[model samples]
Target: MNESAATITKPTPLLIELRGVTKIYGSGAAAMSALRGIDLHIDQGDFVAIMGPSGSGKSTCMNILGCLDTPTDGDFFFEGVEVGRMNRDKRALLRRHYLGFVFQGYNLLNRTSALENVELPLIYRGVPRAARRARAQAALAAVGLAGWENHTPGELSGGQQQRVAIARAIVTEPRVLLADEPTGNLDTARSREVMELITTFNREHDLTVLMVTHEPEMAAYAKRQVHFLDGLIVPGPNQGGDA
Candidate 1:
């Protein structure tokens, strides 16, 4: 083969994957299946939005992806490492070093300054105080909150608080961002602003994004959408998030 042929690229592997994954709660007559041997794979730097109605299993899947829960059967792989084989501490380390999350409620401490809240994850990682403070400041600046870092959550507007939450999520330069209804609490204008910031990060940082949102407008920001129904991923466009 010529050198050019030798340089041809290979198909990229999945950044995250699930194979025949299942999750069942309780047992016997009281059992509830949250995922029924579902298979999914996500490429790095892709943004995917997950949508489903109540009891449709989207949240359960999100919990598993976030490492907050384990599948009852099958396997989950992250960067080709079988997550199911990892002990709790290893999983925690993976989450700490690679995953970032933003929630619908903005999940910030009511009395903490925005900068301090952004520094919380670093604190858990044992980052030195000075470095954490500097990184937190930089993250706030990236999210357009530079001058407002010292404001407490209660002192900030809903949009501002959510910005702080976004700042905190990205402060670690995490590889994947998991956002659940990130704009749920904001007005239309604020929601647009937040989405714009997220989109910029995905484009510029090449951050892989997995978002869960029932609102079609919010999900529209994603590159694609995955619909869930009866514990399995379904084909076609979203079914309007109705179970």
Candidate 2:
């Protein structure tokens, strides 16, 4: 047998990984380093809450994980494939097929019905209208908005609007859900409600969830917490991603 064939290596089992990942914006003296030699790992079905003060690079890390931005140095692996090297079009397909996102701001159209809003991702994938409607309706129902499908964003309450956003995010059944301050715009009661629903999804679907939130109460809902500061992760609990 050949030496190369005898030394076969198994691919990493992690769903997401960042090794020596650094992101620098601009050039020369104008450059701002957002991530400083970060090493993190996320396993399948891991729910991680990324906490930090503003400008701590948590958002930058989130952007890189969501494929919205690229790292200036090091490697990002999704399913052991180096994502940092994938071109923009390939990244878009990865986002469409494997990732879902929810923002603090409910990015819904004011005039569009909740069902249509939930159907948007499916439309992007060229799903037929009937299938899109069925999936969207089921997604809305999963988020506790069964009868409110026809209501526009302007007609829904703040909590209801956020739920609609969640429905839209999960309608595609993505493997990783990237949530940026998902409950930031809601009241305390509503925030807890949203957290409960998120927790339920993480449990029931075994979803890999990465949520960025500064609120401790919200972070507590996650299985593990990762703290960031001054463009680096704090040592201790989050020294490793699964910690």
On TM-score, the candidate that comes out on top is 2
55-127 in candidate 1: lDDT tens per residue? 8898899988888778899999988888965778988888898889999999998899999999999999899
Q: Candidate 2: TM-score?
A: 0.92
- What local distance difference test score does each model get? 0.86, 0.88
Runs with alpha carbons beyond 4 Å of true place in candidate 2: 1-12, 236-243
User: Alpha carbon lDDT of residue 48, candidate 1?
Assistant: 88
Worst 10 residues of 2 by lDDT: 1-10
RMSD vs true structure, all candidates: 5.3, 6.3
